[model samples]
Target: MIMIRVILIMLFGRCLSCAICSTFHGWIKKWIQIS
Candidate 1:
């Protein structure tokens, strides 16, 4: 049970990081397009 919880936490962290990275990239792209 503990192992499963740990794996879930890791996956959630990875997904959160990916979402943040995508959002940052999208913002940068918008700024580049506007410039």
Candidate 2:
């Protein structure tokens, strides 16, 4: 049970980071387009 919880936490963290990275990428693209 502990192991499962740990795995889930890691997966959630990875997904959150991915979302942040994609958002940043989009922001940069929009910035470039506007400039």
Candidate 3:
């Protein structure tokens, strides 16, 4: 159903961003330490 699909996209989008930000921050920390 449309409602179900919308909910799934919203939940998945947030989760993806949460994961991305953590990885991005981790890499930034490493890069700063190396430099």
Question: Against the true structure, what is every candidate's RMSD?
Answer: 11.2, 11.1, 10.5
| Residue pairs in candidate 3 whose N, alpha carbon or C atoms collide under 3 angstroms | none
Worst 10 residues of 3 by lDDT: 16-25
Candidate 1 segments whose C-alpha is farther than 4 A from its true place:
1-17
On the 0 to 100 scale, the lDDT of residue 9 in model 2 is 70
Per-model lDDT: 0.71, 0.71, 0.71
* lDDT digits (tens) for residues 1-35 of candidate 1: 99967865776567756776567557768999999
Q: Give per-residue lDDT, candidate 1, residue 13.
A: 64
What TM-score do all the candidates reach, one by one? 0.51, 0.51, 0.51
Q: List the residue pairs that clash in candidate 2.
A: none
Candidate 2 global lDDT? 0.71
